[model samples]
Target: MLNDMSENQAGYAFAWNTPKSAINPYLDPPDPVQKSALREVIALYAADNRRHQKPGESLRNAVWDRYFFNADRDPVLREIAQDKLTGQARMARERQRFNPEQTVMDDIHAQPAWIARPLLQRIAFLKNLSRPGPCQRYLCATVRPCLDRLTRVRDDQTGPSIRQMAGHPGLEGLLVLSDMNQNQVKRLSALVAAHMAGRLESACSLLPLDNDVQPEAIRRVWEQLAAEVMRLEVIPPAFEQLKRKRHRRRPVSYDRIPGSLARMICTTWWYRRLWQRRCEWREEQLRAVCLVSRKTSPYISREMALYKREQRRKSLEFFRAHELINEHGDRLEMEAVVRASTSHPVRRRNEMMACLKGLELIAEMRGDRAIFYTLTCPSRFHATLSHGQPNPMWAGTTVRQSSEYLVGVFAAFRKAMHKAGLRWYGIRVAEPHHDGTVHWHLLCFMPPGDCSAITALLRRFAIKEDRQELGKVTEPRFKANAIDSRKGTPTGYIAKYISKNIDGRGLGKHISKETGTSLRDSAEHVTSWASLHRIQQFRFFGIPGRQAWRELRLLAGQVNRQHNGRKAGAPVLADRRLDAVLAAADAGCFATYISRQGGVLVPRRQYLVRTAYELSDVQNKYGDRSRRIYGIWSPLTKERICTHSFKWKRVRKTSGGQISPGRGHLFTPWTRGNNCPHGEKINAHHRIRVQRKEEETIKDFKNEHK
Candidate 1:
């Protein structure tokens, strides 16, 4: 407006560079009264322009557009005007965005930034190691006033559950928080970035434990971040100690229900081999990009040429420099890796149990220490460690070889027990001696009168009748033990083997970083682990041991009710994997028709028992809500819903709602209430949980039904 008036009317223009003499570049002193009179004339003159007469448009913009020329003598002044206009337009747009009709997650930014990201994601990220995804709508009503306070989030405070969060646009739904007057978007962004770092720490740590992620500790770290929000120059080191504190558990608890405890060398070898092997290709890719520039003399493959060609198109120098600095060394401590694995201690235990149970069984015969029996295989199906190796004989045997033979022995023993109607307990342990022969050691509590008959049957199965077929069946002794009374109980003699099998207490340990990689590799590459994969080294099956085991477990369960929920018999629809697992856990002990019950044993329904420590497992990942309610996607409801039990959480396939969302659609469980098309609010009955390996399957199912 000034430029137009200055050029056309010569009234609005003032000498910008003129000295501040308060004379308005004129000879007369332009006092406030005089300036006001002059501006009134110029304003009227500028308003006379036809271009400023746009109807229904902003008068200020219309006036400015009429007088403000794109090209003017003062470029700086024009630029200033342009900036003012842009700022006003942005403010208007921001104001327009807060419309109650369209509640966007970003609109909360217009209010304040101290809001917690969706309560669900925040809780999961803080505790469950859930992936950091899009943050849910902010809890503005609950958070706005607390921003300046020193109070902590109250756990008892009710907030939207994960289901509610998923069903609504978070902050937009909070009408009461509309009047909040503050800006914390920058602060909020920093908080979320810190959360992302915390998640990364959880993933990269050597071990991620729930104990290390205490709620109080997390709150303290968050408060620290909040206190220094203004001073944060970059992403503050979030959850740094959480990462530092994470490491594999010492004395890995047996309550974790490990399937095997053997071959520490192979286990560690495999882990390191994978870790180092992963870095190999990454480092090679860097080298490939680097070598591309120096590819004059070397002949490369066609695939290699194309890959290098592509790398050239990218910023190779930048990537190569970073790769060179971060590249892993070519070698690693092979033995150190194995020595640090969960399998190390277990290996000792397995080997000791493999050697001890048979001897202990023999020693348990009525204060006896000398009653022992052995079943030796005469033929060599595989070679042992004693056999010279270029190609070891054990390599030819499969994992099932020993297991199959041992299972046959169980069959014969069970058959003998049935005929004699004996309630005697037995223990059988198997191992391959250095001579490449698999042998079984057995101990059975039997009356002297019945011993010979059962012993004869055992010998028949122990040493196959075809002696010539067994290579050299020399000294195929049927009775190798004489019961000699020695002590009050023989269990101690055998208990040592059990202890060794669990922890390898007496076994010598060897794994060294100084050892050559080839030597370590060779030691781990032997066929022993694979051969024994399918075999159970020790077996116990008898009335006495089973009864006592059940009694001890039941007693333990009774003592810790908090960890072990009541042994309620849950109805399983067989929808999810836990149906069978939990059902077995709820049952007692079983009885076989062949074995007679011992006087000390009670008649109980046989069911598999699991320890409290072993019973902890989760099927639903994101479905577990903040209120301690667990959830799963209900196929019948076509949406995620909360359920108390894992079985109830499964999707119900047979049932379908009559009042669908139209067009063969289904409604979410929460939406089905109040506004239902039916007479009464119909419950969205959940179905057998559709067991899905990937989350996408559940998502796709929901989408298809919706």
Candidate 2:
């Protein structure tokens, strides 16, 4: 019968199988009360089937047909009219209806009149009869096509609703309604069959929301989804996890003292007693983190001594190799002329000439006054040389190798000047002129006579000797000499070479265009004082004593010879300032002179800033020697090693023309001149006048004393 039953209708059948049975010895059925209830339900279904069946035919339209349609031969339902007589034979064959042996049945059988009276009373109590149980109420509610239509829409929200329906009796309600459909009916039939087979409870346990129902009936599905949405909305603050952090504390007070001083005093008892220690625990923690090194003072000192020894050895080696140091340990002087070219080959000849003239004027004012001057070649000479078109073999080197040719020429000039008692500052080679001739502007510092001699010498070697002519040179004229007067005589030459050249014009034109500064003022700003100070510190060494100067000349010669020997195919240049003559010439451009004792005297605004070498205070008695001077009070106690008699010894008077202990007196405050010794100020003296009476009293006291 279940195989023919629809799923929708199965709900009604299941509804009848409710109400737990009372314990009765005679109740053989597993669910006696439900079985009785099902019998009544089947009777109603059989009546309905009969009404729907066609008239007169077989007992198939009867209650038995709906109750047990699969019963092939039931004698009770087989009777036809007199043939299906409801007599003793059929009564004996059919099962007793509703347990006739029960007391209620016997009572009903015995009191037919009482039953009719009860029925009469129930007919007047319609309200009580209309009251519905929970199951009946759910079934009676109006079913809507909206539910079926909603299930057809594919929505993710629908699945939860379906699961929710299965969770409660709601799934049953949905199944009852949907059972009318063929697919629903098949599913319902399977569920019913499983229940009959005793596996329904276990199968339904695994279903979502604990139900065996259709998917479209849940109410809490949307609510659960909303909760899930809420759960994802706000992310928690994770700054504490993501941030980079470090642990640190206040610096130790020991760090307050500088390393140099602290190292000397750190372990002293007095220092430890005076120092304040705060937060010992934190200090210990920091100490642990720092991992203090082992105190191996002896080892450290040994290592330091070793390092010092190594350093001394390297220094000695360098000095020996380069000859920049001597037995006296003074650096050798390097007098060099630095001629930095300002001319751009692409520029006009007039512009180059102007820049050259301006630079010359600067050198002259700075006391670098060029002994001889000439401007014969045009600036376009390089282009002319290129056009001259020598054969490839003849033109062995490119124009870039101009330094090589110039170095040879400069070397020859240096030798000539040396022979003539003129000093060459350096060679400043310029580009070839429009006439295809390479010309040079020489920097030389010599006497007027020597300068004249050099002009004659130039005529001897120059390509067009007739073209080389000398001219008279004088300092440039200025409206105000205030700035000029402040400069040393040599400072004028310093100012001349340092001037900038622009647009084929000299410093005069540039100074004119500049607002707020005069030509003289501009000229004063350009001083050779700094250069002089630097050169004073410049010392050369490694020259044997007898020919020290000659050795330097040789070095200059070596530099020049290397320049000349360079392969024409290789692009090599010579340093113009390497020539001894050029270096000597440039040295004269210095405004301040350097002494072995005094360091540097650089011109500062109105005065000079002098920094001298601080000598030690250690004194040693020597044959006719003055005492030691100023510096550290601690004496240098090294044992005397050299047996040779000292060439330089300390002396006393300023006029002695000797270095002495009172050399500090020259820098002392007592010197009442522009030169303040030792950077100290002189105090003024005040005179006190004695009145006539006071003088007489003083004289009387003096006479009494006599």
Candidate 3:
């Protein structure tokens, strides 16, 4: 009957020849128990087959015959044998489920010869399997064959050693690799490969490992070494497994390594490189999430924005409640004092614009030329194309790396200009590309004769790498234009950029050419990009440093206070030049300030005055002493003038209803400028003591907390 059935009508069948009692040996009267347990299974199976069978065929008779008959034309007594087989298969599958801890042991046991090997050889095999990249792949591919070979070769026998067979001529420089710890080996291997491949230009570039070498360089070199090692093959399975496990673990900060051993490891080149890569990866992951959230929600959630606003309002209220009192009994609200400083965004922007305008005016008066230049990184540094597709040529370069590259290029240009005896002063504005790579826009003022030389030097350094990508026109890499008086002022050209990066004010309906998004919509992302990368957006070079300028202003304030009510002709400083600089700073005239400070061309030490700093009495939270600006010192007069004459202290506010100091009340003098040396530790101790006191005050605190 089965042979007569069509292929589709004859469903899959299981054969059994054993007695029915054998299917369930523990249960007596197995027929009833087995039938009850398998009734659902048998009915489902019969129904499935019946759906596919001919209409006239009896599904019940077919299932009965199929379960009872054997392949040999013999009557099978066991009716539940198929069910037992199904249950056993499922149990075997459950047993084979993946467990990271057991997988290695199971693999080792599969090769019986490995169990009897010497301890050293067994250890080597396990280490090789645990490592990532080529070593692990090689071990996995030839595990069985290699183990058999090892078992056949005795200690007394002479044969090719595993080390000799595995060694590559290119990696001979790393001969002592096996003896070193994992981090050392990885660092040495990467260094050797980078040197051999000529990826690292000079040995000096790798020194002062923490500071000199950029994280991007480390990331690139390690990636190159990894690629070369695992060329033409998929990533090692062990590495993938370990990577998954690491991702599942809680996030670890790379800012500070806790243990001495870990810090020692971080000192190595490879580890530092890995640290940078990990940081970049984390930032990119976060940025991606934020971008997605912004896309899905057109505007920021009103509740979260309002909550943040409320937090700011409360903080301002708290600050307003306190006053920073100087020794003279003068008091100022902390909130008002801080907000009046240049740290405020609107104030900073206004100051920068004023400075730029002053510089341009000075340049015009001196018959100097104003030139605007735009500098961009190479194409490979960009992670995405203009159309928003991932660039295939990008090697995982990040915005921070691109910004660093631009900075280095500018530094080189500066050095070249200094060597050639060129004089120029300007401001540099770093802004992010639509895809987050950084580019620079510079508005420089130079003598008419030196403008060409400056432009040539900038272009040379900017296009030094991947010069071909610019084709016949090099403007894509570096562009220069003479500031035509008819078009607009140099300050006007850069003012919009400053506004866009800062607060996006007055940029109504303006669209970004790079992303085709509204400038107002993308301004927040641009600001966040600069902040996340810690890139300085606006920097003015070839002028007096801002620190000295601030110190001069402080000195001017002190002078004004001293002569407030006195009949003094003029407030005298240490020298005449110092008085002029003080006046310029007081009037907010940057051009006069720059001229009085020995012009933009003069070196820093030759300036009229400099900032004087003194070491703090107490160490900071990091247990390191830091310098604080105390006064201004005139280089010409060789005289020091103290500006920070009065010490201020922070204290809690007292209301009108609060008790005032009485005759018997004891007053504790403020020491160390009222700054706690170990603020964090003291705060933690106070919290613990308050909690204990609260527990003592309340009897049922523990039960209530639970």
Find the candidate with the highest lDDT and give its number. Answer: 3
Per-prediction TM-score, please? 0.28, 0.19, 0.53
Candidate 3 ranges beyond 4 A from true positions: 1-280, 286-331, 517-521, 565-571, 651-706
Cα lDDT tens digits, model 1, 1-706, are 8886466545434656433545455677555655588899888888876455655367767677668744455689879889999999887677656642123333433422222233233334534435322222222322222221211111111133412322333322222211222133323233334443454345335333566754445444343433332122222222233223447445322321111111111223223322232222222222221111111111122223444445444634432222100011111122322333324545444433432333344334243333356775433333222221111222233223544765677587777768767544556666433322345666555656666666666666666634565455445434456444565334444553344334334323423222222322222221232122323556754433332233222222322222234345544323333333323223422221112222212233332221111122332222221123233232322443322221111111213412223422221121111111101111144332322223233233223222
Q: Once model 3 is optimally superposed onto the true structure by TM-score, how far is the C-alpha of residue 634 displaced, in angstroms?
A: 0.7
Error of 2 at 485 (Å): 12
Clashes of 3: 0
How much lDDT does each candidate structure score? 0.35, 0.29, 0.57
In angstroms, the error of model 1 at 108 is 73
Give the backbone clash total of model 2: 49
Q: How many residue pairs clash in each candidate?
A: 16, 49, 0
TM-score of 3: 0.53
Off by over 4 Å in 2: 1-381, 384-397, 424-439, 464-590, 594-706
How well does candidate 2 match the true structure in TM-score terms? 0.19
Instruction: Give the candidates in order of TM-score, highest first.
Output: 3, 1, 2
For residues 374-410, write the lDDT of model 3, one tens digit per residue.
9999987764456433344565455677888998998
Using TM-score as the yardstick, the better of models 2 and 3 is 3
lDDT of 2 by residue, 26-122 (tens): 7665554555887999999999888877554555567557776634365555554445466755674453453323322233334224222332232
**Candidate 2 structure lDDT:** 0.29
Estimate candidate 2's RMSD in Å. Answer: 46.5
- Ranked candidates (lDDT, high to low): 3, 1, 2
